[model samples]
Target: MIRLFDSAHGQVRELTLRDPGQVSMYVCGPTVYDLPHLGHGRFTLVWDVARRWFTFQGLLVHYVSNITDIDDNIITRASREGTSEELVAKTYEKSWWDAMDALGVAYPDDVPHATQYVAQMVELITQLLEGDVGYKTSDGIYFDVSRVPDYGLLAGQPLDSLRAGARVETNDEKRSPLDFVLWKNAKPGEPSWPAPFGEGRPGWHTECVVMSLELLGEGFDLHCGGFDLRFPHHENERAQAVAAGVRFAQHWDHNGWVMVGDEKMSKSLGNFTSLTDLLDKNDARAYRLLVLRSHYRSPIEVTPATIGDAERALARLDGLARRFGLVALAGHHLEVKDDFSWSGAALELYEHVAAALNEDLDTPKALAQLFEALSSANALADGGHEEEARELAVALNALFGALGLSLVSASAVVDEISQALVNERDGARTAQNWTEADRLRGELVDLGWTVEDSPSGTLIRRP
Candidate 1:
């Protein structure tokens, strides 16, 4: 069985499935107001890795990540751009998915849109009001935090402490500053849905509660998002579910933020980098590798230096694939129960990787084992153990594939220009003309080819 650090429990524990041999997960997705940043990429990739690992272990996973099509940010962007909210949401949501595809993230089984569940959200608000757990304010309907005894449970704070630390609200009618909006009364020109309270829309926190319950039913296996969402966003979601007397997710997991230096990357911090921009500039697999190099709950730095290191590491994996003529095993459903026809080093590699992953998804430790195996396989091949090396190479391919990273083999046919440069660099090295060799290598790099030295000559591949 897989174990994960449950945010609710504040420690790593076994992931107990609600249904035997099955996993149900809901990850909070982007709001779709702008292009997805690196933070968005990290969370999606983290969860995607988890889903793939679960499948690799022979357990069926039903993953549902919601797209927040309507939110304050979306409304603000639509108004600023003088466009319809629908168009803005549709356009940016496409960008979000394109980036996800570039990052090799698998599509969730069901992607619930907030706009599609408005009526259900309205019904939920009505239930809360009828139960006397919610009250109406002039601007909107608010949930009374005091009514939910464990309102700040996810936040790891008592209600009184949370209230004291909460930002002072301008709305004096609110019973406590911690009380949050359940429904926002629509403005004159904004989109609105008919509710008994008034013509308005659902609040941000209310949408996920209604959709997750509607789709995954009560007490889903796991709920996950970025660490930043653990507080007001996820806490409020759980509060609403508790007030309604419905069970929410059984396990809560959150991935750490993507950092730009000491600060977390965010639009407000002005340190955010577009995930699409990074994908365009570097190998998409490099970002995944960079993410895997760190613990899921530890912040990762994504600078040129870090990305360049990851790209070089990826080239080593690709080199291994090229050496043995290994085919990619990505996108194939290979369960742990399936016979792999393995023995010796290959079997050991698989067992070590599986053990690392099963222990709280320790990807960093797993990757260290993989790299060590990569070196050992190359050494075996050098020592005339060709068959053993090939077996290990094939196993490495399968293991990386299970992590959603596909290794590229050498190009069978390089363009004449790139081939000429590679030959020139090899000749320069043979002639002991170090300056000329360095210059030629720089040119090849400038042309978007990763240059590496090989026994045959300079090996080049598209990064």
Candidate 2:
């Protein structure tokens, strides 16, 4: 049986997927109001590892991460940015996609935007109302946690204890302090859709249940997110789904928050590091590698020095991979051995990682295994499998792929850049603009792709 950490229980729980041996997973996605950050990347890598280990164990994987387009934050950002709500959502969505691409994270099978599912959200909310689990507010609609009876089941906070967090003063129209909005009455100049709720928009919790039921179905394998989401967010979602007469998902997985310098990383706290800025200087694939070095469920405190160490470790991995001399005859499988304590320890740690991940996503322990694996791989490269390390490279890639940390080919796009420059220079030469051609050639050298002009043609290689 596959096991994953259930945030609801705060314990590793065994899981049984559909079709007797397959896992259908749905992970809660980002808010999309701002740029994706290192914290977001860490949570994504956690789920990535979950999907990968399942596949490694020969289980079919179907993954979906939702995009929340409509929200209070999105509205504020759209107004501030002087763009339409749709435009704002699209801008950040595209930026997030680009960031994920750079980080070597695999694209999900489906990424349905919440705005695109207004009808589904409306229908679900209506059904919850019919089930007596929700009530229509003066402004729009809300999920009455008092009706659910077990509203705080997932969070373990109970109804009374959570009153302070529900921000009841803000929503005086709600029937109870714990109730959450299902839909909001759209105001003038706001983005609205013609729904049963009289031209209002969907609520925050409505999207997940609707999208999950539609894509992964009521009884999907995993429902994963960050630990902070376990409260009103996931709890409300569970109530919404149950009230809609839909089957609830099996597992609830949530990663802990990332703190910086022993404080929660937050915008108000001024400790958050964004993905675009961080990745511009540090390599994304390498950063992903560093993230995978730790487990998903554990709290991470990202710092410049930590990221630098990751870059150094990634450089070592890349250097070792290049040393193997991957030949064009990449047709057969090979075995590898290691001698260094760290490298040996790292490989041996995989067993613990597998066991921990399968036990319920104990990410800290699993990450320990990854560090051990890296150590073992490093020592193996130096001692035992230095020459015959092809399999080691492949295994590292396969493992890293689960974490979405696979090293990108340095030659992949640098070739296209070279070709473009060459064409520019060759055109300049033909046009008798020899000065521009020389400048272009010099630019290529500055970018680390040495361009040598020869009798036959120009040759390009890393300087």
Candidate 3:
């Protein structure tokens, strides 16, 4: 069984599924308004790796991530651009998917849009009202925090304490500061959906509650998102489910944020870096490796130095792949218990990786085992143990693949002109003409090959 940190319990616990041999999960996806930031990339990669690892461990995984197509942000963007909200949502949703594809995140089994589930949301709110757990006001319908006894369960605080620290909105009709909106009343120029309550849209918190329960059924296996969502957002979702007399997610998990400096990256803070910008300038695989190098629950700093270090690490993996002629097993499943040949120290290493991953998805430790095996493979090759070295390389790469790391290098496709330039660059380096060598390297890069200096010679591969 895989153990994960349950935000609700404030502890790491085993992911016990509702159905045996299968796992169901719902992860909060992006709000379609602008290009995705690195935070978006980090959360997506975090959950993607988890889902892939679960599948690798021989469980049927049903993953659903939602797209918030109609939100205040979308409306603002639409108004700013002088375009329709639908166009704004569709355009940015495409941008979100493009970034996900570039990062190699597995497409979710279901991508439900907020606009597609307005009716279900309205139904849920109706139940809350009928149950005396919700109330309507001049501005919007709100969830009554007083209705739930343990309102701040996911916040890891007592109800009274949360109420003391809650931000008070002046001129609001909420009974308590902690009470949140179930539905936002519409404005003249905003998009509106008709319901018995009024012609307005669902609040951000309402969509996930209805969608997760509807698609995955009650008591789904897991729910995951960024740590920022743990408060208010996730707690509110949990409250709504309880108010409606339904069981919610069995386990909750949240990944840490991507920090730009000392502060978390955010658009409001003016430190937001676009995922597309990074992928265009650097290898997308480098970003994934950077994520895997750190623990999932720890905040990660993304900068040129860190990304460069990750790129160098990726170069090592690719070099090992080139040396052993290893093929990628990314899209393939491995039944590690039976499918692959396991024996001797190689088998021990594989088991170690599996054990580390099982211990609450300790990817950093698993990565350490992989690097250890890599060093062993190199040492064995140098000592002329060819068969043993190949065996170790294959096993190490298989584990890497299982973790969703690709070992396949871009195919080297050097045309005649590029080849001549590469040859010239090599000659310049040999002659110690650093200036000319740098110039030729830039030329080769422009021709679509990332050049690297190695002890053997100048190495070139597609970026």
Candidate 4:
């Protein structure tokens, strides 16, 4: 039931798995040069939600997100810090993993580093050279864009008309302005692998092409990354596939960047906030809720006020769970009366929120529905329909679990108190103190537990 825009097709498309339940997905990960920012987190949250919802919908999702361990950025960082490239990659790779985990984002099923796939990339480039889709230059190997008839189809541009606002080097060897590098011969002190052509490393675009083809056989259910990648990065990836006569990604989904105070957050800007900094100020759950407020395709603006609001909302959800847990702990699901159905409402709320999540991961709408369900549950609990309220609360908690969100433990203490109340009631009945029995009933009521007197005894439920 998930529908996302395939930027390659310029249309929102339904995701259909070739096998009834097999959902294969790939997302382009970041180059490990610096810490993660809000801008870097947008597409990650998008795919993470997609994985959660796909599993919720009974699909077995295979997610692979690539890590750009070897890149020009890494090289530059190493040089600036007077450190080895391997050391730089190692440090930032761990940083990246920790940041993603703290933000309530789950790791992909497989993370293949670009450095580990050098051999595959070399093989891919060799094939391209042999196929006449690439040519050698004194500097490196470059993809001959002139070979691919539909070179610019994915980017919605014309190769011959790539003359406006271009920033890349206008090399004399390139036949057209769009003929991007497949490999670059090592400059002095830059890391390089000696190849048949020369000592050089693969280009930024080439690693992804090789990685996707090697892992997903050149065709997959969906390819995902930030909208900024739609141009040269993803477009070049598609062109390589077409030149190799292979099917590329079935659908391409791009999540927009997070704007800083006013501009798009990037490492180049001092306005960017690091994930670690955000984590130091807020718990993982609060940070997650902040990100989930907006649809992934839309631009998200990160601010202190926004995150504070997220924390308040999460607190409300946690409180509701605590209230419901107290009631459900006291009785079995089957023995509950019509008025005491917290578990039922919880499940109902879960269904609605899950459906909202599936429809393109409309997180804000899903979160709104969750808050609405919580409100009703709270009202019901406050009104003395303890069991009815418990049902709704359970649903919200389970859905929160599915989204990988965790508030503090509220379920434990509630259960303990409920058991103690039952014990106290039993003690009063044994002593035959009618006066004490009525007093205990009043005490329980005051504490949000309703005790109803019957012909046999008093029936207790969450109020």
TM-score of each model, paired residue for residue: 0.90, 0.78, 0.89, 0.81
Evaluated at residue 349, the lDDT of candidate 1 is 88
Cα lDDT for residue 130, candidate 3: 89
lDDT of 1 by residue, 1-463 (tens): 6889998989999999999999999999889999998899999989999999888777989999999999889999999999999999999999999998888898899999999999999999999999988899899999998998777778898999987787866579898888899999989999989998899999999999999999999999999999989999999999999999999999999999787887665656544399988888888899999999999999999987788899999989988988988776554343342535568888888889989999989999999999999999999999999888888888888889889888888575688998899899999999999999999999999988878797788988776
Worst 10 residues of 2 by lDDT: 328-337
lDDT on C-alpha atoms for all candidate structures: 0.89, 0.71, 0.88, 0.75
| Residue-level lDDT tens digits of model 4 in 201-247 | 99999988888778876578888888889888998998888888888
Off by over 4 Å in 1: 263-272, 331-339, 410-412, 416-463
Q: Give a tens-digit lDDT track for model 3, residues 1-463.
A: 6788999999999889899989999999988999998999999998888888887777888999999999888999899999999999999889998998888888898989999999999999989988878899999999898898888889999889998887777545778888888999999999999989899999999999999998999999999999999988999999999888899999999999888887765657545499988888888889999999999999998987789999988888987897788987664343233456778877898889889998888999999989988999989988989899999998877788777788975567778898899789889999999999999999988888878886677778876
Q: Which structure among the candidates has the greatest lDDT?
A: 1
- C-alpha RMSD of each candidate structure in angstroms: 3.8, 8.5, 4.3, 7.9
Number of the candidate with higher lDDT, 1 or 2: 1
After superposing candidate 2 on the true structure, give the runs of residues whose Cα lies further than 4 Å from its correct spot.
164-167, 262-272, 326-353, 362-390, 407-463
Local accuracy of candidate 2 as per-residue lDDT tens digits, 1-463: 6766676676776786756767888888998889998778877766776676676666777889999998889999989988888888888999888887766566787898898888888788778778777778788887877776666779887787787676656666777767778888889989988876578888888888889888888688788888878877888888887666667878888876665777665656555479887778776665665656566656666766677787887765555454443322111111111211224433545456667767765555665665555566667767867533445455555444444444433443456777888778878877979899889989888878767664444545563
- TM-score, candidate 2, is 0.78
- Return the TM-score for candidate 3, rounded to 2 decimals: 0.89
Error of 2 at 36 (Å): 1.5
Best by TM-score: 1
